[model samples]
Target: MKVPFNSKDREVCIIGLGYVGLTLAVVMAEAGFKVTGVERNNHINDLVNSGKAHFLEIGLDARLEQQVKNGNLKSVISIDEVESASVYIITVGTPLVNNSKTTNLEAIKLVSEGVAKRLKADDIVILRSTVKIGVSRNVVKPLLDEAGVEYKLAFCPERTLEGKALAELVSLPQVVGGLDDASTMRASDIFGFLTPTIIRVTTLETAEIIKLINNTQRDLMFAFANEIAGYCDVVGISAREVINSANIGYPRSSLALPGPVGGPCLEKDPYILSEGIKALKGNPALALLGRTVNEELPKVTIENIQLLLDKKVTSQEKLKFTIAGLAFKGRPETSDLRGTLAIPIIDEIKRILPNVEIFGYDPACSNEEISSLGITPCGNLEDVFKDSSVLLFQNNNPAFEKLNLNSLSRLMRQNGIIYDLWSQFDGTSLELSNGVRYGGHGLMYLYNK
Candidate 1:
């Protein structure tokens, strides 16, 4: 891919400097393009201008600071401050509506209208927000068309993970789709500065559906694993053991581990996809079912914890529960708590056992930050284990995986219960310990023993 124009001469203005937008802005600036970040929030604008990222992600702070110092990137509170740019990218959030599964596109609409007001001829406009299918053609295109501007439009959905955004932005193949050939080519040329591989699709809707399908498929696989884990619990078998044994040297099967599937993307994208399918008069039964299974996981987890507590602990009021890991996902760790299941789990625990004392510990988050979420924060692992009657491993953080269970068991109350949601530890062997009673989501043998 040859450079269509001098990269240093191209100015890229990004709308909505949230997690996705801020990271992309930093990457583009680091790639040698003069970048302008538009943010409506005064606090966020101040934070960005001061070279500090509002959220936690690996390597984002250092990179953002460097970009700000280099003068390659600057932020403004109003879109009017964006005088001119070769490319305009909309990265606004599309959150779910209140008490509904449907996507709320108010931010998208506002940003599109804001961009349209400053539209210029021959400029490239790209949307990187994850939205419902047909959003690009039906919602955004009409707004820009009404503005009477001659510009190339494209939809390039963001696929980078939360913690690994900077690395993946440069490594992963960029997916590009546009209204026409010229639009697609221009978008590809822009993204080519960051990554060598650019996947050009046929239509804008294809690019939109690709992001929806990618996330929904993963949600379905996780739902299957969770369903199997529930069945294993009923039949006195280990779902983790069955899945591992079933997949060993097997080319046909790939089963995702059963855990809480709530995240910013997985929790809402399936609903958006299902809604789009319904609008087309199609039945999205599988998508809806997957959402139900994953959404109900926190409730199911609380029910199992109640059962385990009833079997071991005699007094509910005296129970002291300590939870580990608060973030949504663990592998590519992050401090983002959007759509996290840990909060609901804590709420459910309080609803069921109001007198119980709950404390949470996550290395990714600070103690004050955790406390702000209505959770009592533990200063250290020692503080979490001491005198706690129940230990619930909620998130699958690597630090929790490396914990010495035998040594920690001595610090807890005698015959204390350890509820492992991620199957990080062998619950079967823990049941043999005299000091601790072990139980996992799929460990039915623990219930029997």
Candidate 2:
């Protein structure tokens, strides 16, 4: 099979049209590449053909629809499309599963096998999937070698924020690396259309390591913030206020406050890296510690509830809990809940209070999605606020911040625990409420209503 690296529109084949894949495909097409999005599932293709997007990213669906109309983007199912592209980018999922510490990179592996089988000497297979440090070099390259295909391969991990992927694709500096010098140069040239600032790494392993380190470092920072927040709760100080005030002069030290560390990348990728390393080195510091701290957030969150409920709960009253916002992050309304941070918190809530009726609410997700997790979904914002003992803010949705404190107090069951996970609440208003307990990172303020 001849590699399609000819001059005709620099044909690009992107495998997997999930959140990352679909966004990257649209970005490439808009940048004047003839893009063919290949997905194993036909559902995504149907959505694309119908001018709809499966996931929510800012202006992504409209951009994709425009590209499709302009005759620059096309969708297909067969792996035979691999033979029709100059560059094949594998943008598949790498999710962490139950009973396994490591992530399942089966999609990446399958795509690599297909690419290796169809690759020619001058072809490039760019892996845009987030994987462990040595995956590209140790796993992918070996598969290519076994298939008797000589080609350039690069590890170019996607670091685009979900809501702002299109802008970030052009602005964010991309880290790319390949097996050889020629491979690295080719990968850099191919991605030049997406972003001008490209940092080329020496080895494939180094490039892969760059992706892992980015998430692991962020995880470490968040873990530190969460740990410090607990200490702030004991000391009777407002953590968010202190951090916000101190952030004025000490710019470098200020990072995002501790919230749910779910989402796809931060929760899963670090374990893949740490688990791979632990197999060889026995113990890793930041990666393992970060995972432990992040996983423990739900339990820690539930403990905060107990602290608030101290001497308040009587035998007669039943706790009515409401969870606000279920998306992994705020903006553009995505439905991908691979490594959801809210799950642990939900699990803890269920385990501790079996009698409590937990109701979850998200603007983006449906009842079917929440029901799959064994939880009942409250239809809307008003439904969640009506007569609840506690309101847990799992995600930082901007819509939740606009809520009326007085109106919410009326909906509560007297002395309700207002668990502000992202601390998106007014301290003054919370303090004014009678029998309302408001707690967030480092500062737990109880309102005697």
Which one is best on TM-score?
1
Q: After the best TM-score superposition of candidate 1, give how far the Cα of residue 87 lies from its true spot, in angstroms.
A: 0.9
lDDT of 2 by residue, 271-340 (tens): 8788777766756676768878878888888877866666575544567788887778755456666677
The C-alpha TM-scores of every prediction are: 0.95, 0.92
Model 1 poorest 10 in a row by lDDT: 1-10
TM-score of 1: 0.95
For residue 18, model 2's alpha carbon misses the true position, in angstroms, by: 1.4
Instruction: Give me candidate 2's TM-score against the actual structure.
Output: 0.92
Off by over 4 Å in 2: 1-9, 81-83, 279-283, 315-318, 331-333, 431-434, 447-449
Pairs in clash, predicted candidate 1: none
lDDT at residue 316 of model 1 (Cα atoms): 48
354 Cα displacement, candidate 1 (Å): 2.0
Cα lDDT tens digits for candidate 1, 350-383: 8887768889998888877788678789999888
